[model samples]
Structure formats: C-alpha cells, structure tokens
Target: MTMQVRGSKLAARLTASMAALALLGTGAVALAQNWSTTVVASDNGHKVGNPKAKTKLVEFMSYTCSHCADFAREGDAAIKLAYLPKGDVSYEIRHLLRDPFDLTAALLTQCGDPKKFMGNHNAIILSQEDWFEKGRKTTRAQQARWQFGSNGARRQAIASDLGFYELMENRGYTRAQLDKCLIDEAKANALAEASQADVEKYGLTGTPSFVMNGALLDGVHNWAALRPVLDKQR
Candidate 1:
C-alpha cells in the first residue's frame, strides 16, 4: 500500500511538471515573436505592425467613401486584433482624394500630431454618415463660400460651413488649430498632387483599393476576401 501511494504521488508530480514546462514553452514562443510599427518616410501614410512583416498591405481610401468607411469598420478591427498581434503583417493607409470634402477630411486628419493620425482617421471614417448629411443641408451661400475662394480658403470654408470643423471639434480639436490646418495651402496642394500621382501610377478606378506586397489587388474588396490573402502571405 505504501509503495502504491508513493507511485501515485510521483505520477502526479510528473504530470504537474510536464504541464508547467508546456506553459513555459508556450510563453517562450510568444515572447520570441517580434512586433513593431512605424510611420512611412513620406509622412503621407501611417503604417502599423512589424516593419519586417512578411505581408505588407496598403489601402488607398477616400474619407467620403461609404465603401471605404465600411471596410475601415470591419477591416481595421481585424487587422489590429488578429494580424498585427501575430507580428507577421504590416498595414498602411494612403489617401486617394476624390473631392473637396475628401481633401478637407484628409487635411484635418493629418493636421494633428502624427501619433494621432490613425485615431483621427478612424473617427472621421466612422462618423461619415452624420457629417455627410450635414453637408447636404448646406445653403447656396455656404456652397458659394466653399466654391469661390482660393484653394485654401475654399477648403476652410467647406470645413466650417459643412461641419468638418465641428466634427474635429467634437474630436477635441480647437478652432484655432483647425483654422491653421484648413488654410495650409502648401499641404493641401501637396496632398492633391500626391493623390493624382497615385491615380496615374496605379490606374485606380475608385476608392477603397488594396495593394499587397506592392501589387495592386483586383477584386479583393472587403475584409472577408482580403483576410485569406493576408493569411497566405503570412
């Protein structure tokens, strides 16, 4: 009986030791994974996740695009929660301006500190419907204000009259800071030129386009379709 009891106790100890070793091995594997993020050199795109990631994903999106907004809601979440954590994927967003409203939103998003760009971008995209409705309610005078001024002035007018300024304010921006961003002619022109250059280079058809590993992806429009491609690359 004593021998049997000792044998049982030894087996129990062996099982516990094996379990502890397994847990430690799992932790070591997790720790070995390398994850990191950085802003691109151009300062036009914000990148997140491992710089040396096997999969590089880029999105060309317009703020006023409903489809882009949809993708931002679902796709951005999945990237942050799944791919980024795995440390094998990196994601970037480049603006493809579609109109003045898009430019206004883009400028406002980039106007803030670089660290806040993604947060602002996500907020702007998520609140598109509400602000777009406000834009539609603009009076003829408001439209003229947005249409008549110089590029900087016009963009500022559109931002204020169409509620883009108000939207930023809701996001904790001050009027003075936004006014400075709104009237930055050089930045606005640069953004416009860059967007046009991307269009010509990529032969882009519309907003919410995707590029993976430097190849423009065709027919891969949503997270459901794109997720599998990312997995394969990983």
Candidate 2:
C-alpha cells in the first residue's frame, strides 16, 4: 500500500508538470504572433496586420490635416494592440496629398527601409502641429523655394524649413538618406498619382476617410465612430 501511494503521488506531480508545460507552450505561441509588428509597404499605402484578414480597414489620410492627425493619435494604438494581434483585421493607411507641404511629408514617410514606414508615418502625423506652426511662419523666400524648384528641390526646401529634418532625425534617419528619398521623382509622381486615383476611386472628398472591406464608410471619420464599427466586426 505504501508503494502504491508513492506511485500515485509521483503521477500527480508528473501531471502537474505537463499542465505547466502546456501553459508555457500556449504562451510561446502567443508571443510568436507577429501580426502586430509585421509591416509592409503597398502600392501607395503602408499596411500592418495579416494580409489574409477578413476585415480590411483602409484609412485615407493627409499629413497636413489636423483631423487625420487626431485619428492617428486616438485610433492607431488600440487597433494595433487589439485587432491586429488577432489577425482578423488589417489596417492600411493611404495618403491623399493635398498640397506641396503634404506631398513633402508623404515622401518622407516612405523614406528608408520599408519596415520603417509605419514608424515614420506615425512620427509625421502625430507631430504635424509642430511643423505646421513652423510652416505657417515661413518666410516668403522659403515658400518660393517650396513652390518653384524641381520636385526634389522643392520638397527638400519644405523639409528643411518646416523642421521635418529634425523630426526624422529623431527617428534615426540621416539627412543624406532622407534627401535621396525626397529626390526620387518616380516615387514622388507615383505617390501623387496614386493619391489622385484613390480620391476618384473611393469618392474621397476630404481627409481622414475610411474604407472597410471594400465599402467606403461615409461619415465614419473619427475614433469614437470607428470603435463601435470595429467591435461589431468580430
């Protein structure tokens, strides 16, 4: 009887060990999920989350728009944390360039590695005010430089004058690398052309528009309105 009792005790210990291992395996699987961190550059947009996700959320935003900035601050964190990790929802941000200043900033967002696009995009949009103030106070000389020069030169002028150089430098980009991206005429024209194409294709009339699962979400522009829709999606 004593030997049988000891065997039962050992079996209980072994069962507990297996349970703990199972729990650890579950945690490892969770940690291995890269849906949230995986970022990719699309045609004229930057996307994050599982490409195969059923619910595709596309945001048409402009760097120069305050409302777009507001959405970036309020909505991005939750979406990245909640929806993206589940691999059920994907978020893509498309630029709708409205002006030279907007196009200048958009070019900078596409600078450097494709993996860095999301961070660069968030940096520009969230810090829009800091640069907008500087843009407002720019000298006529600076404005002329932005408007009349070659595509790259004009954007380069905007970047220098609006404190964007300082902004991107904070993100660990050197001036030379950034200038190279700024001067890429092919990229500039592509982004601009894509922006116009999106405007017409989606009937986008303003900044901070939304398209979910191929249907444009009219009047659903801000976080408060969007959260409910996301919650109902899954």
Candidate 3:
C-alpha cells in the first residue's frame, strides 16, 4: 500500500512538470516572434490616440471591412479618451490587406513618415463610410478583380480610376510619390508577405481583431463592452 501511494505521487509530479513545460514552450514561441509595426508609402494604416503608452494595444484591420470602420467610428474615441491620454496604454495599427488594391492602400498609408502613423490612420478611418459605400456598388467579381488580379498595371489603373489614387493625392501626396508607391512591385509584395505571416502566426481569420497583451479581443462592435478587459490588464 505504501508503494502504491508513492507511485501515485510520482505520477502527479510528472504530470505537473509536463504541464509547466508546455506553458513555457508556448511563451518561448511567442517571444521568438517579432511584432514590429509596418508603415508604407500609402495611407492605409490608422491610429486614433497615443502611440507610446505602457499597455500596448495592437489592432489588426483592413480598409474594406465594414466592421473595421464601425470600430473606427464608435470604439476608437472611447479607447483614446479612457486609456490613451492617461499614458496607460499605447496602440499600434497593422494592415490586414485582403487584395492587391488593399495592398495599394496599405503601401500608401505606410509611405509617409513613421511619426505620421496616427495621421494616416485617422485619414483612412475618417473616409471609411464614403469609400465603403462607393465600393459596394461594384459587383463582387469586379471587386475580386480589383483585389487579386495578376495584371499589376491594369489593377492600378482601376484603383486610380476609382479615386483611391486621387484620395491620397488630395491628402498631399504628389503624383510622383503616388506613382512611385504604386509601381514598386518589390515593396508591395514584401508588405503582403509580412501581413500574411502575421495572420498565420496569430491564427486569425478576420480583420478588426485586437491583441491586448496576450489576451485577444475578437471584435469591436462597441467600446463599453471592451473597457473592462483593458482595465483588467491595467
């Protein structure tokens, strides 16, 4: 009977050790990965408030996503007011480009000065409703053509004709800068590849996702519901 009791204790210890090892393995993997922010020559990234506060809140977003726009309109202000201004939290916006056009916007957004990240972010979010509404009138096949087509020249022409090019131009990007950003095949491909790597690493399938520390906030339909989670992290 004593031998049996001793064996049981040994098994328990072994199981506990294995569990601890598993936890450590997960942390080691997460630590190995880097999550540096990407900025391109385009106007696709968005930031609403503080960038250097303590609790970093990184949001994954796409330009074409209505839900993303909703978060921009509703939750962004509250998050900025309650958390950002106090220096308790900092936020980073990352691109989740779905197609080649989305890539264009992403590239343009990142094209400017890194310090202008917030301005570029705010610009995209402010124009969200209008751009989305205009985009929806087109057929899905056309949208897909806009997004995934292999013909870079034609695709960019479509983006320009649709006023995406003009939109950034209005934002003070010179024609030369816009053309340079749009035609750089290497940079755009790299950005797309990096964004894809992030999606797979995070195991995410949708846009407008949030990562507050290690905890995930799946969506941002409303801010009142999200405060407690951020507060708890504080």
Between candidates 1 and 3, the lDDT winner: 1
lDDT per residue (tens digit) for residues 1-234 in model 1: 999999999999999999999999999998876444344434456787777778888899998889999999999977877788667788888899888988888889887777677778877899888888888898888888877868778888888776777778887899999989988888888888988988888788887889888888998878788888887876
Model 3 Cα displacement at 226 (Å)? 2.3
* Model 3 lDDT tens row, 127-203: 86766666667776666666554546644765564567767777787877777767778877787777887788776
Candidate 2 Cα deviation (angstroms), residue 103 = 1.2
lDDT of each: 0.82, 0.91, 0.67
- Off-target runs (Cα >4 Å) in candidate 3 are 1-52, 136-155, 218-224
TM-score of 2: 0.90
Which is the better candidate, 1 or 2, if ranked by TM-score? 2
TM-score list, all predictions: 0.82, 0.90, 0.67
Best by TM-score: 2
Please write out the lDDT profile of model 2 over residues 20-46, one tens digit for every residue.
999999999987886988888988988
**Cα RMSD to the true fold for all candidates:** 4.5, 2.2, 15.1
Kindly report which residue stretches of model 2 are placed more than 4 angstroms away from their true locations once superposed: 1-20, 23-27, 31-34
Error of 1 at 51 (Å): 2.5
Top-down TM-score ranking:
2, 1, 3
